[model samples]
Target: MAIEINRITQVNKAALRLPNQPFKRFGTLLVTRTETGWHHQEQLSDQTFEQTFPEENYQLSAIDAAGFALGAFEGSRCVALATFEYDFHFNRYLYLADLKVDPPFRRQGIAANLLNAAEPLAKAHHKRGLCTIAQGSNLGANRFYLAAGFHIGGLNTNDYRFTSQEGDTDIYYYRDF
Candidate 1:
């Protein structure tokens, strides 16, 4: 497939809205704090579900305003998206806030292409690298991030505390330019 990556400007940010898609949760990554530092181990499971987040038009516009967002288009339809911004706290790396590929478009390298397209924009901003957070339970996303050159930089076991997602660790990944 010939996928074209393009910047998602305010006028076209609505293309960021992706339909809710189901996925199989094969396992979870359990992160623990050892005497030396943080570590992660996988716990396998079998489950299927779908989840969705609020992707209001206003929110997309804000993301475009704050930093940069990229969309992968097949013809005129947006099939994949990635949004990132400079990390205020880190002050060096671009924080990847969101990345999603339509279910039918999976395993097609569209996400990878979007990442590749975003790097130059981040570098243009003088960023050292790209950083992102993934739920430890999302084995697929974790593996993709790793394969995309992001390493496990940090983990927070308390990221989802006191919520339905409690016990879910947030794994932070970093890919240096």
Candidate 2:
């Protein structure tokens, strides 16, 4: 059976009710965020960032406050997530962070869909581009970001200080819309 891309509408409307066949055929998925559901948002936050960074830190909180939280759900189950944070230093830009696809849903183009959804949002906010940081040791993430059209901007030594650990290396990547 051919998967019809047109059947997947970006915006949901009551008149265009998705058929159960298509829902079953494509596995009925939707992308949404925490402001839509407080419980979902809390679960998404706990699952997305708890293992990687200081979950209770002020910086992360600021990021969460300013950022747009996104998640892909199959029915009510959250299968993937990505967050975008727009920041201004030398210029205005957006940072893509905490991109994660559930282990069972990997290689299904979900990440691409999430990114596809983000580009316009960034553009609407007048962002010059999108950026991301990948740990040097995480080769899979490094390759994934690169494959998604993000190019290496630079490498920083002792850039990130997490807890008591010091001198962590992080590679930055950016893509102009």
Candidate 3:
């Protein structure tokens, strides 16, 4: 069956409840993994992927707990995800983080659609704007964000320096709504 994408609207207690039928029947599922202990272990296993952005612990407690999380599901599987948090450094702007699409679902426009869902939510919350940080080595992601209407703001060198991982840079991008 062809895949269909849907956005989750309500979030309660740091959990966004996704529609279950499409996920259950179509094999699309959204999984939220926020356990700091589990994330710490996962990061230790693969520092490269972990240090590409802020750690999951930071995401779970500092961001997800306070902002919005959106997922794109196909059938019962979560094919894409986007997380946003209020950034005080950017004058309380909403920042998008950890936008990811399952490898098998890349090039299907799932990620773009996920970001599309986040735009209005930021506006409704009266945020200054939306921003995202892309890993410097990830050319495709950088290009994708740029094509999706994000402008390059500046470089974030050693952004993940505290991470055990070595040699990575982050680039900041923003879009004014």
**Model 1 score (lDDT):** 0.80
lDDT of each residue in 1-177, candidate 3, tens digit only: 455544444332222322211111111111123543111011112223322232243334454466767777665566666677765364646887567665667788877787777777777878867788766555566667777887766665667687853455666777777
TM agreement with the true structure for every prediction: 0.87, 0.61, 0.63
lDDT of each: 0.80, 0.55, 0.57
Ranking of predictions according to lDDT: 1, 3, 2
lDDT winner between 2 and 3, please give it: 3
Task: Assess the local accuracy of residue 122 in candidate 2 as a C-alpha lDDT between 0 and 100.
Answer: 82
**Candidate 3 Cα outliers beyond 4 Å, as residue runs:** 1-64, 88-92, 160-167
**Off by more than 4 A, model 2:** 1-64, 160-168
Q: Backbone collision count in every prediction?
A: 0, 0, 11
Compute the lDDT of residue 169 as modeled in candidate 1.
Answer: 81
Q: After superposition, how far is residue 88 of candidate 2 from its true place, in Å?
A: 5.4
Per residue, candidate 2 scores C-alpha lDDT tens digits across 25-66 of 111112132544311011111122213333322233444566
TM-score of 3: 0.63
